[model samples]
Target: MTSWLKAAAFGVGGIAVAGLATLVAFQERLVYVPVLPGLPRAYPVTPSRFEIDYEDVWLRSSDGVRLHAWFLKHSPPVAGPTILFFQENAGNIGHRLDFVRMMMQRLHCNVFMLSYRGYGASDGHPSQPGITIDAQAALDHLSERGDVDTSRIVVFGRSLGGAVGSVLAFNNPDKVSALILENTFTSILDMTGVMLPFLRFFIGGSASNGPKILNFLVRSPWSTVDVVGKIKQPILFLSGLQDELVPPLHMRLLYEKAAEKNTKCLFVGFPDGMHMDTWYSGGDRYWRTVQLFLEQNVPRMIDGKLSSKDEDEDDGRDCLQRL
Candidate 1:
């Protein structure tokens, strides 16, 4: 009976080791999900479908990896601020056209969104280092374009993309006018505990208790908290309190960190908003908050001097244009 019990325990231990090994081996697959089951590698639709004018942009990263993006100009182009959008993981920029259309129509800004390497028609597999290069490449491409209003580029990111935007803004403070993040976590190491509570024993007690085996194995740390304090640009945090994937506490933590380091940080929370539906659930308050933030922060060239748009004009539009 003792021998049988020993064998059973050994078997369980071996299985547990195998599971950990598998997680370490293919963690990138778990993090950067470019496509869902039955979702095509090819884009389902284009910006033209919504009667919006756009240009398909092809860029090569610093490491020579090819990337894809869409540049949607506001009417007359370069007249207003340009929003450099960073999308959440799990889908290509193709899936975000409706949201893009809504933003362009309401905000009256030029929009540029990139497909990080491995996603959409871009080349190479997705990783933290590679995606970071891709974001830089997108910015470089915009800088080269004479038609883009480079002076007023606002970096907007959601979830995983928020981490990406944070890193970019930290690295290039002069290039980015303002930063906006939505439903972003502090770090993937912190997120590991949130998603798989059982793994907490392996990760440790605090979020920054580093050098643990599980933390070492994380290929893409994407630690937004580490970089948020380093960014000098004005930051607007849109937090969905009801987010299921990434807890609302993550955004609050990020805001606190950013506020401590940078004076110009604002956080807006939506009580009923979920992980992906905050823009819709937030309603007119959401649009007004965003519009007001932009009006105050993002600047435009009036004649030869830099100036912000007037904030006294109220648009008074609801969130009927749900994406």
Candidate 2:
């Protein structure tokens, strides 16, 4: 009996070691879920339904990867504030048409939705650095456009996109006027622990040791907490109170960190909101909050003259007033 028990223990130990090794080897696969080409019913809606004119744009990343994006222009001749929207991880740009339509029609702004490499019609594989490079390319595309007012550009990212947008806004403060993050987390390691606390024991030394091992293995840190302090632009954090995928506490913590820099910031929470349903759940209030944020942060050309103070200099009192 003693000999049999020892053999079983050895087998269990070997299985655990193999599991850890496999996790480290294929960690990127766990992070990025790209939908390959030739999937049926990819796009559910048409741009014409929103009465917006859109063109298919292909952007080349700094690393020579080609990215696909939709450049949707407002019906008006002179475009308003342009939004460079970064979507959540799971779907292509077509999956977010409703949200884009709302932004264009209700907010009266042009919207640019970018698909990370390896998703949709874009080329190359998706990685932390690769997606960030794709985001920068999207911003550059907007900046070079004659119709867009580069001074009034806003970087709006949701979930995973929030991390990308924060990084972009932090790196290019002069170019991006404001940032809007929805249902974003602090970091992948932190989120992993939150979502799967039991895995911490396997990944780390023990409960006391925490998730140090998991953090070391994670290739895409995408740590928004580290970058939020560096972002000087006005920021708006949208949180869903009942978010199951990413807890609402993450947004609150990010808000606290961003507020530390004396930057203009707003946090809106939906009591019954889920991960991607904040906009629909908040309804009209959601649109109003977004419009208010833009009005406060993004400058407008009034009578062919720039209105409002410089974006970086604004105290964000406008945000407080609305709150």
Candidate 3:
């Protein structure tokens, strides 16, 4: 090759190497967004504001990382089904109080939601392995609680939380009664290409034949697709067709895989629902779908039928409005 061409080629190669190194070194920052812009780590609101009975909880992960959570109860003796919520990547569990309140009001089930290690009041940085440990700790805590019914534990996760919840359910099939995944991607390996289209060229083929180094650079490959097939529990997939972050196709892939193993696999797609606004856009239909799924799969749980009273009572008012 000519001298000028060779220099240009060398420069491009060096830049590519540097870019790959940067991604490998700091990829966690991009994956786990504990705090969004203008959103503080401190909770903006809590279940108490909505008059919902809740307890501030702290549990230690297997690695001894302190994790923060809120255990919300329907009435008193928390004997029926429980919904273990796993939040999206951008914020802490506190941001989901409204959803928790609605679930309790409509479903009459206990809710347990925890901030993974490194998010909110939880200790340590978030990584795939570390968050996995954190999820296990949360489940262990629930299992130990006398108020919780270990048999009817339903795991509900959104976005990145879906991947985390999937891992937890795959690991403990007997412990989890059902799983709900919303706007979740198939895997970090798949999401890398979706978020960064150029990477598709380098990581398209099968694992055995694909560029091994490019795959290695994916620090946190929370491969939900790899484990959903192994989860024998009932699973409900909520996909927002208009989800800008995670394409609706990802949810389809997960549903297909899970259906192969579990007959109770259900998929619901919202035509106008976006990544973060599916609950809002889906209106009563979204909640009804969830209620029906839970009722059908998880026997003896409190009725979650979305009634007009449930709609008029708290649905209209913001959770921040304390009565």
Candidate 4:
């Protein structure tokens, strides 16, 4: 074959390779994705000790997938904010005890730290719809509190949990007291740029191929962009400046798109911290910030529709000092 023909063939093969890579990475079993074993023994997670008390909570999704979680209700009722925490992408609620202990004791709020489908003993698999269903189930469980105030409930998430957080905030802003996202990204496209690098360019480079084909061929179920603007509740975003995993710039870009500036929304950054360790590594300042945020926005129980998105009426967080 002539050199021109050979070059053309090679170019076609490369496109084929790239296309195949995109399809497989996106469509692969998300079930196995959650099942990745603990990190290599040589580089295991070194967790420090903290006093975290525990309790087992079971929730069945609307679809009947039984999920597991830890309900660390505050001891003897200090009565601050009740937080429904979505864990980072990982094993189970057990790993988050140190942080939970600090929040429960320090933040003075009851914390329910829960896992998605397959992470812990939860039945079924992890996927976009599945996790959303799982979250709704847990939210329903929280709604059933007799002594617990539903209006003062807070929703917090980190990393993949942020996507979970966004979904909850978007669909049922009324159920959430306030929304807190840590180390989250703008969208799955942004995440892919961070994870795969430069492929976002090609996704739009030749759009004459049409949006439907582009949509079908594209990978990633983690799109938070649409949900980002939909969330109308008070929001606080915590990002690490030096984070390479999710990148602070992504979160910053997201903060810009939020609908209202008056929703008690603010983006806080740690100039010296990394991805996951921002809170723990920042020490006293971190817990103080977390506690103050809950207190400032969530407020003590006022006894009337605490978490809903009522435009005319305002809560303690909104009307705290102003009113």
Candidate 5:
């Protein structure tokens, strides 16, 4: 072979090798692992200085899938909807035990939180589909409980949980009295790309999207515009100016897309609030916003009991608008 031809061949081979290496290493988001296809897991539930209080509960999904959940009850039941707390993507419900403790102290209702299939003691691996099924299983479990008021049940999810909650609330509109989304993006894809200005372009590539490739990191099942419109339930969205996981503007876009003009859609954007703890750091205003929402939307019936469901004020639409 000629010297120039040989050099050209070597160059092409080097490019091929580099590209293949990049493809293999980043194809599944490098370090991001799917929580599903995994087995039973557990994490420590750390409370605040008060030793975050909670009750251990186990429930099975429809497919006989077992899930671990934490039920945080408020003493002296007040007339309000029971909160089914769906958390963000992280270790487990145990990680947010401190937040649960604060919820119990502030809100005058019950709070139950469960881990996705792979996190905590919940059985089965986690996937977008798996989490949806498990959420339904959670709803089923709550429905069977004699103490739970079906009409006054509230579905609350933060970040990734918002996608899960939106799907559940959309399907069973009648079942969900209201919805509360905190630091939640419109969809997983939106969460990873659209909301992330710096890394938005990396959705199709890797090494750039380190831990967001395979772990339910595709098109998210939750479409806030669709879900919020279909369900007549009251909705409240909370977000922070500095929530890195699920950017603040995304929350604003979600608010604008909501169809109902007077959907009772409220936003509580804290000037200095952090991600999940916007409520924690915002102090009285944060808790009051939530309390006021629950008070207005999930007010008592003639018997004085539980019932029903943010952020900025940005006016815009999401890509889902095309859908």
Candidate 6:
């Protein structure tokens, strides 16, 4: 009996070690789910379907990887703000047409939707650093366009894109006038804890060292919380209280961190919304809040000089209080 028990113990230990090894080896696969290039019927909708004028733009990342994007111009060509939109980790830029159309028609802002490297028809693989480069390239493309009002650029991102946008805004404070993040996490590490509470055992306690061991293996530690405090640009944090993936606490923490330096921070919570449903759930209120933020932050240039003094006169606390 004792010999049999010893053999079983050895087998269990071997399996655990094998499992840990496999996890560490391919952890990137678990984080990034790139849809790959050349999938038939990948994009179900296009701007032309809605009668929106758009240009299929091809950009090159700083690392020389060619990226795909869509520059959807607002109708009537008003000198309004241009939104550099970074989408969630899943799906290509073509998958988000409904939201894009809503933003263009409601906010009346030019939208530039970028497909991260490896997703959609873009070249190369997707990584935290790689996508960040893609974002910078998209921003550069928009900035050079004569039709785009470069001074009134807004960086809007949702979910994983939020981290990308925040980092870009922090790096280019002079270029990004305002930022909007929806259903974003504080950090991938923090989110890991939330997703796998059992991992806490690795840090300390009696749960087992599995989580602690795996934590060190995460390569893409996109810690948005660390960078939020450094951003001085006006920010709007939209949270879905019922978000199952990221949770509302993450958004609140991000809002608190940004508020430390950015007195222009605004947070709007949607009671009936899930992770991706905040925009639709909030309805007209969502667009109204976004419009208010744009009106206050996106500078109005009369003759190469900022003409709007509304942002200077009022802090964003009143706006948050009303929400």
Top-scoring candidate (TM-score): 1
lDDT tens string, model 2, 223-254? 88778877899999989899989878889988
lDDT of 1: 0.84
Cα lDDT computed for each candidate against the true fold: 0.84, 0.81, 0.83, 0.69, 0.67, 0.82
Candidate that scores best on lDDT: 1
- Tens digit per residue, CA lDDT, model 6, 1-323: 69989999999778666655655777566567666346552566778998989999999999999988889998788777899999987777777889989998888889999989988779998888898889999998888998888888999999999999999999999889999999998877666556545444442212123446555666776788888889999999999999989879888989998898878888888898899888999998888788877877785788877665554655544554676
Q: Which regions of candidate 5 are displaced past 4 Å?
A: 1-41, 46-55, 194-226, 260-262, 304-323
Cα RMSD (angstroms) for every candidate in the order listed: 4.0, 4.4, 6.8, 6.1, 8.2, 4.2
For residue 229, model 5's alpha carbon misses the true position, in angstroms, by 3.6
Model 4 weakest lDDT span, ten residues long = 40-49
Clash pairs, model 4 backbone: 151-306, 174-308
Better of 3 and 5 by lDDT: 3
Let me know the TM-score candidate 5 reaches against the reference structure.
0.74
* Model 6 CA deviation exceeding 4 Å by range: 1-19, 36-41, 201-214, 303-320
lDDT of 3 at 257: 84
- Per-residue error (Å), model 4, residue 157: 0.6
lDDT of 5 by residue, 1-323 (tens): 99999999999778656654564455333212323235334465333335544567787777777878766656665555688888877657766777776777787777778887877777776666678888887787777777777777899888778878888987777788889888877655544454334345434222134544343445333455445555667788888888856668877877776645535677768888777678777787777677777766776675564333223522122211111
Count of backbone collisions in candidate 5 = 13
By summed lDDT, the worst window of 10 consecutive residues in model 6 runs over 201-210
Stretches > 4 Å off in candidate 1:
1-15, 76-78, 204-211, 306-323
Model 1: lowest-lDDT 10 consecutive positions: 314-323
RMSD (Cα, Å) of model 4? 6.1
Runs in model 4 deviating more than 4 A are 1-19, 22-33, 36-51, 204-213, 218-220, 259-262, 302-323
Better of 2 and 6 by lDDT: 6
* Cα RMSD of predicted structure 5: 8.2
Better candidate number, 4 or 5, judged by lDDT: 4
Q: Candidate 4, after superposition: displacement of residue 218 in Å?
A: 4.5
